[model samples]
Target: MELFTLSLPAAIYIFVMAYIPMFGVVVAFKNYKYDKGILGSEWVGFKNFEFLFKSETAFRITRNTVLYNIGYMALTTICALAVAILLNEIAKKWLKIYQTAMILPFFLSWVVMSYITLAFLDHQSGFMNGWLSAFGFEKIKWYFEPEYWPFILNAVHLWKAIGFSALVYYAGILGIDGELYEAARIDGAKRFQLVKHITLPQLTPLIVILLILSIGNMFRGDFGLHFFIPNNSGMIYPTTDIIDTYIYRALSEVGDISMASAVGLYQSFVGFVLVIAANFTVRKINEENSLF
Candidate 1:
């Protein structure tokens, strides 16, 4: 009875928030007229999906979304693991300070990050341009260029996300049996050898779970990061555009709610399939590491 009571609130919240909203998915197949409402609207079958599949910008957005997510997953994991290992070596006296500094960015809103990026990247009266002038170099227009955005976005995402991911990894490291490390040291194992043979092997299950979860988001992009950071510049769309931003533009500019919903549904479906496939592969390799 106590356990059921403990879980009751979460059950109700999930039913109200997650399950109830699922019914609106039907809006994707409907014309979604304001007057007719969701269920009352005309069913157009797969007509709305055609907007996404038929558009010339379709391939560009899809490629950007998948590539950006893949880059984020791979780079974030590597950097986070590295940072976590480094943090484990820090002295206890300064550990809290280092943790606070690193985790601060994770809590900041993307809107704030966008303005912070603007301050540095602005062509005139910007820090970067000022440095360029001092060094006798041409001032580059950061927002107008698509080529530089991939690196910029990756750096920004890392800055905001690495702290939290590192914290998770750090905790995992702390939970590791200290006896293992002591035993390795007694055997004359170097620090690198201990990490390679002991620490990494123990952390492999956690890494696999996180990776599988990240794979689930392979079809989605950070909408705010792509949209606000570039300030919605058309010139940079070739590099910065993703499915989430594309759907927003479709709804806001074109006012095609049904089409936008269809694209969103597509993203959700693909993400779901990716998660299942990833979990299945992991199960085949190591049943213990599989999310299921």
Candidate 2:
């Protein structure tokens, strides 16, 4: 009874926020009209989906979404693990300061981050250009160049996101039994060896669960990061354009709500399949580590 009472608010929240919104999914199939309303709108079956798949930018957006997500997941996991391990090794006196500094970026909004990026990347008066000039190099138009965005986006993402991920891993590290480390030390195990054998093995299940959850979002990209960071430059669309941003443009520019909804539905379906497949593969490899 106590547990149920404690969870009641969360249950209500989920029902309202997550489940209730599912009814709008029917909009994906309907040629949604303001006057006719959702139920009264004409059913177009798969027409919206067809329009999405047939669009010229569809492939480019989809490819960018998937590749960027893969890169983000891999880089975030690796860096988070390294950061967590380092935090675990730090002296208690300085641990809190290091943690506060690293985790500060996680709280910053993407809007703030975009402006920070602009301050550094602006062609003429930017910090980066100033440094380049100091070194006798020509100023580069950072936003106009699509080639540089992949690296810039990844770096920015790492800076903003790694803090939260590292904190999660750090908490997991804290939960690990201290006796295991003590025993490892008694066996004359070096720091690297202890981490490789004790820390990594103990954290495997936590890592697998987080990875599975991340894989579910493989088809979705962070819209704010891709949209605001590059200032939505058309020239950079070749690399920065993603499904989320594309859907936003479709709705905003074309006002094709049905098409946008269809694309969103497709994104959700693909993400669901990826999660299931990833979990299945993990189950096959190690049943204990499987998410479900």
lDDT tens digits, residue span 1-292, model 1: 9999999999999999999999999999999999999989999999999998999999999999999999998999999999999999889999999999999999999999999999999999889999999999999999888999999999999999999999999999999999999999999999899889988889899999999999988898999899999999999999999999988988898899999889889989999999999999999999999999
Candidate models: Cα lDDT each: 0.94, 0.93
The lDDT of model 2 is 0.93
Compose the digit string of candidate 2's lDDT tens values, residues 46-146: 99998768889989998999999999999999999999999998899998898899899889889999999999999889999999999999999998899
**What TM-score against the true fold does each predicted structure earn?**
0.98, 0.98
Instruction: Give the number of colliding residue pairs in candidate 1.
Output: 0
The candidate maximizing lDDT is 1
Task: Give me candidate 1's TM-score against the actual structure.
Answer: 0.98
Candidate 1 clash pair list = none
